[model samples]
Target: MSEVAENIKTTETVAVQPKKPAEPLLSKRRKRLMSDPLDEDNPITVQVLGICSALAVTTQMKPTLVMAIAVIFVIVFANLIISVLRNLIPNRVRIIVQLSVIASLVVLVDQVLKAYFFDVSKLLSVFVGLIITNCIVMGRLEAFAMGNKPYDSILDGLGSGLGYSWIILAVAFFRELFGSGAVFGFPVFESLGLAYENNGLMVNSIGAFLIIGLIIWAQRWRNGYVEHN
Candidate 1:
């Protein structure tokens, strides 16, 4: 009778043990992780990390879009891998491991571009390889991925990637539209049978600088973000 009673007590104790609550997939904190970079913490206009690529590849939308996609892949996967391995990584070699991970992903992206999208790859030239040294990718791995959980790191990566993507896309949009009167090489104005003169300024780096500056100003104005002087 005591054995049965003890068994019952054990079962009851086991049954009453509380389970940890599952975190919501898109908790308020997680949503902020995904949203903050798109506006207030933008990599390009706000953080000012990837201006060179913006200047170089954004003359045409096709190459710019390809670069954006490549970056998004690299950043997302790199964050996930690093976050998963964060604990196992030795502090002294963490930077080296992070670089190795980023380099491997960038090589994969570069090869895929070369194998299938050879023409765009050629257009991209060294730019795809240059992603290895991009500040945004390195910065995210160091800052967010090194400390956060895999899922949170991924959301941070997506946020930063999309933030970078839209800014370059916006710049490329204006540059392509005015520089060549096209969108994704569709030749929009040409299709409309309107003879749109390509703006020489929009075809040059000066054009990108001007557009980026205006965007920075406008975004800050809209968001009311101010530098602490």
Candidate 2:
């Protein structure tokens, strides 16, 4: 009788075990985390951070695209690693910790670029290394990852990475198109049979200034982001 009753208790315990609840991958808040950086709260156009790389690496789509991928990878992974270590790190050393993590990731990216994309590595030169100092990466690590759960931190990083990516890419597209009469080294104007001269101004830094300025104005105007005193 004792054995039978013990087996009944064991059966009930197994039968009554509760399953873990499912969390939505893109809950309303998470979706906002993933998207808000693309435009409205854009790191480049809106917050006006990471402007140096925007002008420097955007002369052509090829190098610009490689740089974008590098940033996205670094930011996303850095956010994940930092968020995981957030609880254990000392507040006094947080900034140091963040920079160390960012610098480590940038080195990894630089090596990968050197290995597989040597030409782009040369084109990007110090700018890839300079990603260590990019405000967006550090700001996100300090702002969102420090306080958020791992998944939310990842989403925020993704949003910010993509936000920076598209803007520079747009600049690159125009610069390369007009500067070389080509897109990604393909002769677009020539292929289209359009009689176009290579715009010397477009290849220069001055052209990047003009392009970025126009983008800032256009984005703000379309979004109705007016500045008020």
Candidate 3:
């Protein structure tokens, strides 16, 4: 009887001891992904990071959409490449490496845009190349992608890029409609006799500025970032 009791106690102890604790690796990875800068507080909408491009190519729908897609591709791929090579990059020269990766991808995107959408590409001109300077790309590398896994970094890049794209598209929609009387090159106000027909409010930079300002105002209002003065 004494031997049986001892055997039962030993078996219980072994069972409890073999039960493994939750791995910190996966939990840590998940936390990193969830806390990425994209969803919680987007640079474009919340911090209002890249408004330059928003005001530039937003005069037309096609150019705006093209710019959005290009930025998305550049940011995502750049983040992935940087994450993969993060370990090899010397701390002193990390910024240089990040810039190189972003510039290369931006150039690639520019070539593709020029080849396929020549007319729209011409309208975009230097602005497309300026994607390299957009803070969202660099911010992702420095903030989220540098220390995270490749998959999480990719998603963070994509989410940040898309967040920027959405705001730009929205601003462009308002600018194009009110400034030009057209949406995506389709004549909308003609039937209503409200069309400008030539060189309307939409084609000018001031219109973009005003529209972007109003957009920023609206966003701030909705998010309670700004109170009415």
Candidate 4:
């Protein structure tokens, strides 16, 4: 009887022993805030979105840098605003609300650019207006921002924007030096005494395209997406 009671007690203790729970999945808001930029999912290099501005504004180092900063500002703020008002936005008209928010931010950025840097603004021209149509901006709003907190969405937007900017600036450096015979608007090859009196390569848009293509190619090669053979 004593042996049977001891056995029963042991079985009860084993049955009552607690099982550890699995770790919880990351929250929607946390996932948005912590995503990386250089992976296969990057908007610029991988997804091939927003290449128009990448080709247009990257002719000169300064303008390319400025455009990149402007994009970062617009994307971060737009995401923050959209996330904040996500619940209030009607499902039927969510897209319209998102557009309204993005458009307002773009206009504000344009106004600031015109007020302080009129010449650069003129050079940018329609490109600045086209920021509203940048796929990354809209994509974030639909994918991550709408379901996340304002702070997390903003960080995600800013990271992607800066990732795009860094690539653009690198492309501009090579384009400006080789194509323009200049760096940051300073003529560096005057002593060469070249036969062509003018720096003709920098002025054309096709030059921008070539520089961007080479950069994308080089990046792909380095990442093992393309082989030297």
Candidate 5:
């Protein structure tokens, strides 16, 4: 009788206790947030964000690489700051707050580039400052960082920044290869002893546009992404 009573008491205790949530190193949704933007949800190719910088800075691989690193630094830090302060920001002025955070990070990036990469910074010029207005940084902050935990926001920023980085790097690769017959100022054509004329059009802003558009098209097709009517 006592054993039966003790078993009933144990059963009641277990029934009343709440189940603990899973605490893995990384949740499934967090991983998705980090990875999806790399391809399927890419900010540039899929969402079509941050096209101006892609066109402006992609003429040469050197400057383009510097710009990509700068953007990644700015975006990751900005997202982290905003995510940590997400709940404290007022709704009426949230946009302003986000912009301020982004602008500060951009300044930090610009200064670091100027200090460490003076020549590349000169090549970049106003474009580095213009990162303050980049839609990708602001968009991610508002959409993902604002609503997510700091770790998830960091992943989202890293993914989005890389998404933009790889596309621009590809654009720069082609532009430098065909436009100047070189990659990062090394004469590939000359080194190979092959005669090749640099394509003037490939060094132009229009070339960046065409390349990025074609890349977006190819990515969408590969990913089976279609627009709705």
Candidate 6:
């Protein structure tokens, strides 16, 4: 009789135990949302958004790195704010509302940069203010943030920011290396005891355009992305 009671108690305990909840961090959809923009669906390389700053600020890596961080902050916060307010926002004024949110964030970034890192902020100049007009930030807010949950919108913004960051970083790396014979202001060629002449063109705007064009071509070819006639 005691053995029968023990068995019943064990069965009841087992039956009452709850199952583990799924890990939101490891969800397939979340992974895809973050990873897709790094390559095939990249905002800059693939979709060709945010190219102005890419060309303007990528003359050196340090300033480019700061700009990238600023952009990431603006995009993620803007997306979160927009997503949370999507339901409350009026349809007719959605564009205006989105612009307002983005502009506010851009001002905050600009002020913070001015307060600290003033030199790099000065280097970035009007480009930092121009984040307000970035199409990537606006596009994601309208297309994804308006419809998605806050968490998903944040991830989309992050993926897009990172996508833009990497491409510009690559451009800066090459430009600084060949253009100034340095990386991040360090005299790389000088340290190596090699006499290197900096390429005048590499430091100029045309160099940025050429590098971006090659990057676009290489990425598209590798991904089998082609214009359909």
Best by lDDT: 1
lDDT of 6: 0.88
Clashes of 6: 0
User: Candidate 1 — which pairs collide?
Assistant: none
- lDDT (0-100) at residue 166 of candidate 5? 94
Tens-digit lDDT string for candidate 4 (23-111): 13344544545455544356777778888888788888888887888888888888888777766678899988888888899999899
C-alpha lDDT of all candidate models, in order:
0.89, 0.88, 0.76, 0.75, 0.85, 0.88
Residue 202, model 3: Cα distance from true site in angstroms:
4.3
Candidate 5 local lDDT, 146-227, one digit each (tens)? 8866666777899898989999999999999999999999999999999999999999998998898899889878988888
Q: Candidate 6: where are CA atoms >4 Å away?
A: 1-23
- Per-model TM-score, in order, reads 0.89, 0.88, 0.77, 0.76, 0.89, 0.89
Encode model 6's per-residue lDDT on 122-192: one tens digit a residue: 89999999999889999999999998766778889999999999999999999999999999999999999
Residue 211 C-alpha lDDT in model 6: 94
Which ranges of candidate 5 are over 4 A from the true structure?
Answer: 1-22
Q: What's the lDDT for residue 189 in model 2?
A: 92
TM-score of model number 3: 0.77
lDDT against true structure, model 3: 0.76
Clashing pairs in 5: none
- Write down the worst ten-residue block by lDDT for model 3: 10-19
The total number of steric clashes, by the backbone 3 Å criterion, in model 3 comes to 2
Error in Å for residue 9 of model 6: 39
RMSD of 1: 8.2
